[model samples]
Target: MATSLPSHPIGVFDSGVGGLTVVRALMDRLPFENIVYFGDTARVPYGVKSTSTIEHFTLQIVDFLQRQNVKMLIIACNTMAAVAAEKVREISPLPVLDVIESGALCAVAESKTGGIGVIGTPTTINSNAYARAIHQMDPDCRVYSQACPLFVPLVEEGWLDHPVTRLTAQEYLKPVFVEQIDTLVLGCTHYPLLKPMLSTMTGNLKLVDSAIAIADQTAELLQQQGLANTQRGMPDYRYFVTDVPLNFRNVGERFLGRNLGAIEQVSLDRL
Candidate 1:
């Protein structure tokens, strides 16, 4: 998002706390940039919701973030990226980025055998968004997909390495493993939190986390736009949510790898 407005905070949002992983990556990659994050905690799990509803909620958050005067927007929820990115781009004033397309591009580059595995929420997997994006980029890539609906809640609940989580991964990944894919795309933002367990399960397989791709692109865009923040001190990190600010405060730190200080509970209707 190259822009004349270099000081505007970068806006990032998801259906819930999972998007914090993207925020965390941005923090690591662009420590001096300001950030404003909104988690739709009142209505979590956008993966199960209908496309129209996802678009509605997404636009509401985008409107709210636009009011904050952000220079860029990142759709960290894979499901929303799959179903709602076009609408988001249509309405957003700033540059918009999504997780699915980035991961697909990365998978195509990282895969050695042209065999790639994708795992995401049922809505995301059922949509076949990753496979399509991969094939569009490289017609020879073989795509294997699985929908792990339980992974979101499991990560939110902080069951990162629990046996139940491992067992669940084992069961869900059985088919993908059979495809002999060399690269696995963690299609959902929430799946990154389960990295340790997933690493053990998909041994010797390269894991493609969309956060890296998104962060790299964000930095590249910032440079291209001459909007890179040049300040050196700690930058502002403010957070807002639709509901349960405290709950997000509790679970969000794990996703963010730091305390989410002074979260504001907002009513989108009021905004």
Candidate 2:
């Protein structure tokens, strides 16, 4: 008898729809691979949660994905990626990818003045995940970080280009602009939706989207491991959420920039 070939899908999770940004990147970057995404919407805004709570939720999602036979895992939320990535790696049998390091590396590689600004949730900023990663790669680099706790709620509420969002972006980024930084890291996954406003506020600064960087890294790793799906056939993508609101389809479609075929609501207990 021949040995069985692994036919598992890629598992991606986040605190909420923010991770759909990562999914969009993966779909564009790795068209052959199938993806399974889980959004913990009932527990949205993981940024304010305790480290222990985030870790526990992360593990539960990873375990659930393992049950679905995921070949690899991507922690798409910045808060969870910053605080619980290591713990998930310890228990996962598959390769685990996180967003913080990839975004940091990209910022370091693209910065010319050695000045980098990072914006994320309170947890991500307070943890200094981006600052630490950038400094480790280049200690001479100046790292400025700010917490934009409102960005998540704004993004979640689907207010990307609202006048209020523009004002909020200006207010939050004023300090970083004063420092004359040339690189800005969208440390939080949700922040990418606000990129247009952020760009307007930051002038000519280079904006780094962690979702894009991580997607690139994911492609390279899969190819290096000889696990890159070689199929040219249509790949299936599944979306699941802990709590599906009436506006989930509308909000998710906007976030993903495409229709989410069908979203199934699952209990957190099931995970």
Candidate 3:
């Protein structure tokens, strides 16, 4: 059996800084737990990649995190979660938590009319993971999915409320609203960065941010597994990246909602 401990840092990875939203939520939800975050900055924008390529990249990150001795794993990237979560679980001895599953659960519980909408990258939407997950939970729930292909780039550019971003959001969400959904799942991790604007644009639609949902689910899972960190002082937080592109710290801190502190760059060859 794996010798997982409550004090072992939880491993979180994303194609890029998007997953930091989940890390931010986890910080707020579980203030005492240690965290180790990895961002594949060099090979980001995995949305355009093929299934086999995405899966290959995801497993490499999982293996690296496993070597870090994480007590648990959180697949914070929607694309990775949709494509490789099952594969990761098969090889990982540690408990795995994914944002897609958490978001689906939250959507089902929040939707009163059983009308749910999901917005994500082309890959996630194409995978039909959110709709399938939602339907599995509640067969009666109607799922409306949209591929907001530009949101990630807009978010990465730090145009959270730019006029162009707002216009794009309006154009992308129009069809979803036509379905009369009461709940909208921000299926992509990066989508949470645009929450304030999304909330304003999507009036009265309950927004299920996967970051927050996953954090809540993580807390519950830790409690159930008796792995909730007991020590309360400042916990360790480490960040690893394949490369530090221009404005990496700035964009990352924006996603994290705080200073990124010191970041260590690791080569992909190391994985």
Candidate 4:
């Protein structure tokens, strides 16, 4: 049903700048593909909001991105994906991809001992989305979940590898470690920014970075659909935000691992 061309940009959106991590992975995996990213910076921390509110905001973003003529839609925010991914799919004309499903699939495949750990925000963990998803794929695998509410702010603050971060991670992961999990799913997009520190602390535990998993999945989907960009020149990247919060540029640049070019702010009425 999609008449989208290979040259069309892919739309990726999140509650905040965390989705930039997904964008970074996409840039690495699909170098020729253009991307349009939207961050709902004005009303971030969607974790605390009601599901209906989250869904409403997500649909607004989906509507905005659809106007960009994107070939596909990617829900980069774990909370949004958990709450409104199906709703997005229902209305979207393009193929929809979500990080939660990708992360669950990757976690299931990567876990050697059928023991997997999951770390996410309180909302994501409380939703039991990851556990449900993992069980749907592999009912025999044991899922150990922990809610690390502090990781997001820590990552946004750029405290990666800091002593305070290390201590916080250790304390948060103690319960999961006790379960003896062989793979740890980074359920929050922001958590991927802490991969180096998490990897260092967790040693041999495989970390399922949803960003990388979704990027790989997107590449596969693009190839199968014959929508992969054939040209090799520089790809266009556009960023949209609801509001420019304090230190947003700095935090977003860290998450994206590069300079954010031009960021356009859109009003809610327009979204």
Tell how far residue 209 is off in model 3, in angstroms: 0.6
Query: Candidate 1 regions off by >4 Å?
Result: 1-4
In model 4, the Cα lDDT at residue 70 comes to: 95
RMSD of each: 1.8, 2.2, 1.1, 1.4
> Per-residue lDDT tens digits of candidate 3, residues 1-271?
4599999999999999999999999999999999999999999989999999999999999999988989999999999999999999999989999989999999999999999999999999999999999999999999999999999999888898999999999999989989978999999988988989999988899999989999999999999999999999899999999996456688988888898888999898998
lDDT for each residue of candidate 2 in 188-228, tens digit (9 for 90 to 100)? 88888989877777778999999999999999988777778
Top-scoring candidate (TM-score) = 3
Identify the candidate with maximal lDDT: 3
Report the C-alpha lDDT of model 4 over 55-174, residue by residue, as the tens digit. 999999998998889999999999998899989999987999999999999999899899999999988898899999999999999999999999998987778889999999989998
Q: Report the poorest 10 consecutive residues by lDDT, candidate 1.
A: 1-10
TM-score of 2: 0.95
Number of clashes in model 3?
Answer: 0
Compute each candidate's TM-score over C-alphas. Answer: 0.96, 0.95, 0.98, 0.96
Q: Give the C-alpha miss distance for residue 90 in model 1, angstroms.
A: 1.7
Off by over 4 Å in 2: 1-7
When sorted by lDDT, best at the front, the candidate numbers are 3, 4, 1, 2
In model 1, what are the clashing residue pairs, if there are any? Answer: 2-225
Error of 1 at 143 (Å): 0.9
lDDT of 1 by residue, 127-189 (tens): 888999999999999999999999988987789999999999999999999887899999999
